[model samples]
Target: MKSGDKVLETAGILVPKVCILGVTITLINKTTEYS
Candidate 1:
């Protein structure tokens, strides 16, 4: 149970970081395409 909880905590922390990074990359790609 404790290991599962830790995994969930790690995922909670990582998901937003991944989401923000993905969004930044996509936006940069779009800007470069337009330029």
Candidate 2:
């Protein structure tokens, strides 16, 4: 149960990390295009 909980927590953290990473990548691409 503890391991499962940890995995769920890690997945939760990863989901946001992935989202932020995608946003950052898009922002970088836009900045590069504008510049």
Candidate 3:
């Protein structure tokens, strides 16, 4: 029960980190193409 809660918390944190990393990668790629 408690382990499930911990898993959920970690997943919540990981989701945003993954999203930021993806957005950052795309931004870098766009900058590279333009410059």
User: Candidate 1 has what TM-score?
Assistant: 0.93
Candidate 1 lDDT by residue in tens digits, 1-35: 69999999999999999999999999999999999
Overall lDDT per candidate, in order of appearance: 0.99, 0.97, 0.98
lDDT per residue for candidate 3 within 1-35, as digits (tens), equals 69999999999999999999999999999999999
Lowest summed lDDT across 10 adjacent residues in model 1 is found at: 1-10
Off by over 4 Å in 1: none
| lDDT, ranked from best to worst | 1, 3, 2
Q: State TM-scores per candidate.
A: 0.93, 0.74, 0.82
Model 3 stretches astray by more than 4 angstroms: none
Tens digit of per-residue lDDT, candidate 2, span 1-35: 69999999999999999999999999999999999
Model 2 CA deviation exceeding 4 Å by range:
2-6
How many pairs collide in each candidate, listed in order? 0, 0, 0
Backbone clashes in model 3, listed as residue pairs: none
Candidate 2, residue 2: the lDDT equals: 95
Query: Distance (Å) between predicted and true CA of 11, model 2?
Result: 1.5
Task: Give the number of the best model, judged by TM-score.
Answer: 1
Q: What is the C-alpha RMSD of each candidate to the true structure, in Å?
A: 1.1, 1.3, 1.2
